[model samples]
Target: MPSPTKETRTLSPLATLPATMQLHPPPSSGTHRTLRRLQSAHSLGAKAAAQPSLISQQRFQAQNQQQRQQFQRLQPIQQKPPSPARRHVSTARSPQRGRANSDAAPVPTTTQLAAMAMTATRRSALSKRSLAADSMSLERLLRDGPPNDDVEGALESARLKILDQGIRSDSDGMSSLRIYVWLILLNAPVLETDTYLSLIHRGPSPAYSKIRNDTFRTLTTDPLFRRRVSEASLIRLLNAVAWTLHDTREDRTREPSIASIASSSRQSLDQLSSRPGTGHSGYGSGQSHPSSPAAKNRARALTLTTEGSETSMAAESGTYVQGMNVLAAPFLYAARSEAEAFIAFHQLLTKELPGYIRGAMDGVHKGLALVDKVLAIVDPRLSLYLLSKNLTAEIYAFPSVLTLCACTPPLPEVLRLWDFLFAYGPHLNILCIVAQLVMIRTKIMDSPSPNKLLRSFPALQADQIKRTTLAIIKMIPDDVYAEIVVHAR
Candidate 1:
C-alpha cells in the first residue's frame, strides 16, 4: 500500500519477481530471457558482419601506404620514354587483353605436320629424279643405238622413260625428239610426203570453210604458237585431214549392198548356166559351181564395210569440229613439217580421241562430270564449298576438257602438260584440271565470289600442276579413276 520509490519505479515488473520465482521462472519469463539472449546474439552477429568490411578497409589503407613508400623510394630513378616506333613494335608484339589466345596461331597437329614433312620429302625426291632424268636425253637414246627389232618394246621403253624423266625442252618447248616421241605414242605410221601432198592437192574440202573460221583463232594469244606455226600451215593440215575424212566417208557409202551382190551373183550363175554348159544339169555334170568374180568382189566389199563402219561413222562425223583447230595447233607447232602434223593429227582424231572429235562431244561432257566426281572424292570440303557456290566442273572445265587443257595459257606449259598426257593417258587431263582447282583452293575459299577468280584460271605452272596431279591420283577411288581414264575416249 506504500507509494513507490523512484528506484522501484525505474525497475521492470519482471525484475521485481520473488527470488524463488526468479530461480524457477514461469513460461512467460523463460520466453523473455530467451528473447534477450536472441537479441544479444543478433547484436553480436551484426557487429561480426560489419567487422569484415572494417578489416578490409584497414588492409586497403595498409596497401596504399606501402605502395606510396615504394613510389617515394623510386622517385629519384628516372626512365626514358619509348620512341613511337619502339612503342608500336612493343604493342604489336604484346597480346591484347581478351584476345591473347585469339591472336596466337594454333599449332599444327601431329598428323598435319607429318603430312607436310612427307610432302617435302616427296618433292625433294621428285626434284632429284627430275635431275637424273634430265641427264638422260631421249635423243641420245635413239641416236646412240640402231633401231630396235621390236618396235612396240622400244615405244614402251620410251614411254616409261618419259614418265620417269620428263622430256627435256628449251624454254620454247622444242626438242628434237618431241615430235617423234609424240608420233610413237600416238602409234602413227610413217606417212609419205606424197600421201600428205596428194590430200593437200585435193583442193578445199567440205570443211574448208569451217577450218578457215577456226584457224585464225587457234593459239591467237600464244606468241610461241604464232611464232612457229602460221595460220596457213594450220589451214593446210586441217584441210588435208578434212579431205581424208571426206574420201573415207565416200568409200564407206559407195560399198555395194548385200542384196545387190546376191542379185549380181545369181545373174552371173544364170549366164554361166545358159551360155555353155556341157550338160543341162549344171551341178550333176562334172563341172563344179564356183563363186563368181563379182560375188567375190561384193563379199570383200561387204567385209570391208562391216569391219570399218563403226570407226568410219565416228570419224567422219567429226571431220572438223570447232575445237579441232586448237587441237591441231599443238601438232603443227611441234612437227617439223605439215605432213607430219597432218599425219599425227589425223591419227589422233581417228584413233585416240574419236569420241572427243565426234559431233556430240559426249566424251568431253563425261570428262567434265568425272572432274567433279574426282574432286569430290579427293577434296570433299573444297568440293562442297564449290557446290555451295553452285560451281560445277562443267562451268569452268569445258575448254579444258574439249581442248585437253590446251585452252590454258603459256604455250610452253601446255606443251609440257601434253607430253605427260601423251606418255601416260590424255584422260589424266581431268585430274590435271582438278589439280589446278586444288592449287588455288585457298584463294577461292576466301573469295566472296569464287566464280570471278575461276573465270580465267591463273597461269599454268607445269611443275606444280604435275606434282599436284600425281598427289591427287592416290586419293581417287579406282572406279572413279577408271571413269577418268576413258571419259575422254
Candidate 2:
C-alpha cells in the first residue's frame, strides 16, 4: 500500500490563499509543526556541510604559511656548511655509547632468549619457596589436628560420660577427674609415677627404711624411667617426664603390693650413700664423691610425689593464660608439619557458617556487642595482649582461644595446658577456658588488671580448670559463631 502524505502550506503571502481557496487547503497545526521541523533540519544540514569546507580552507592556508616559514628559516643554514669538528664530535660520542663490547657482532638467537627466560623463571621459583619456608614453618599438630581417629572418638565419648556424670539439671558437665589425674601423671616424671603407683598399691606409710626399699625395687623394674632430659630439644618429652616424676614408692613403703620395690630402692640408696656414691652425667663419667649421699637426697627430693589424693596437682590448669603465654611453639614443633591444617580448621568453623540459621545472631550491632563483651570480660589479659601484640585480623581469626599465647609462660604451666590441647584439640579446650575463666572470675577479678592477670592464672589447679572449660564449650550458642572469624580457618 502507498503511504499517505498531507498537503503543505507556508505562512508567506504567496503560499497563503484567499478565504474561498480549496485546491490545497491551509495546513493543520500538525502539518505546520512538521514543516517547521523540516526547515530547521535543512538549515542544520547546510551548516554541517559548511564546516568541513571551512576546515579545509584553514588547513590549506596553514600549509602555505608553514612552507613559507620553513623556507625562510632554512635559507641561512643552506647558505652555510657544517663544521668538520662538529661532525667528528657527533659521530664519536653517539657510536661509543651505543656500541656493544666494542668488538662482538650483534644478533641474538631465539634459543638464547628462551634459555635466559627459563633461568629467570627458575630463579624466581626458588626465591619464592625460600621465602615461604622462612616466614611460615610447618607445624603438623596445629596443622593436622589430632592424628589418632581413636583419640577423637575417645575424647567425644569421654565428654559424653563426663557430661552425664557431673552436669546438674541447670548446667553442663564438670571436669573429668580421670583427665585431671592423667594430666598430673603426664607432667610428673615416669620413675616417680611408677614409685607412686606402687606406693598407692600399698597402704600409706612414712617409714624411711621401708619406703626407701620399695622405691629401689620400683626403679629397677622400670628401666625406662632413668633417661635424662635434653634441654635444647624442642618437642615435649611427656612420657619421659611422666616416667621420672611419678616415682612414688617412698609414699607407700609399707603397702603390701609394692613393698618389696620400695625396700629394694631404699637398700640401694643406703648402699650408694655408704659407699660415698658417685656422680653421673649419664654419658657415664663421674668419680666417687664424699657428698654423694646429700646430692642423692636432693635428687630424690626433686621427684614429683603425688601421694595421698593423686589429687595434689600443680596450682594451675592453664587455659588462655598459658596458651596466651607460649602461644603454641612446642606443639607446632612436635606436630611440625600440620600447623596450617589447624588454621584451615579455624577458618571453616569461624567464617563460613553464619549463625543466623540458629536464630541467635543479633545482626551487626549485636554481633559487635558480643565481641566487645567477650574481649572485655572473658580475659582482661587478652586486651593487654591484643594491645601489646597489635593483633592483626589474621590473629583474631585464629580459632583457638590460646591463639599465640598458649606456650608463652613457664614450662610447668605451658605443659599442663598443652596436655589438655593435645588430648582434646581446639573445640573443647578453647571453649572451656572461657567458661572456666568466667566461673572463677569473681575470685581473681580484683587481683590484677588485664596485664597482671597474666601472672595470677598460672597457679590454677587441674580439676578446677577442667570443669569451667567444659561449661563454656557446652554452653556457647550457635548464633555467636558468626562473630569468630578465626573459626573458618
| lDDT leader | 1
| Candidate 1 lDDT by residue in tens digits, 99-147 | 2232232223345434434433332211112222234457754544223
Q: Residue 201 deviation, candidate 2, in Å?
A: 47
lDDT per residue for candidate 2 within 1-489, as digits (tens), equals 000000000101122222332122223545434433433332333234433333333344354445435434422112111122111010011112222232222222345334434333322221111222222212221133223423222222232222223212111111223223222112211122354344333433322222332222211211222221222121122221122223332242233332243344443112211100001111111112213574244223322233343443332110111111123233323222222212222121222222211111212123333433444444566434444543321223121232312322233333344444333332333443444344444544454443234322333343445544433332233334323322312
> How high is the lDDT of residue 446 in model 2?
55
Cα lDDT, model 1, residue 410: 82
Best by TM-score: 1
Which RMSD values do the candidates have, in order?
36.7, 35.0
Model 1 segments more than 4 A misplaced? 1-136, 144-156, 253-316
lDDT of 2: 0.28
TM-score of 2: 0.25
Off by over 4 Å in 2: 1-155, 158-231, 235-372, 375-405, 408-424, 427-433, 443-450, 482-488
Instruction: State the C-alpha lDDT per candidate.
Output: 0.57, 0.28
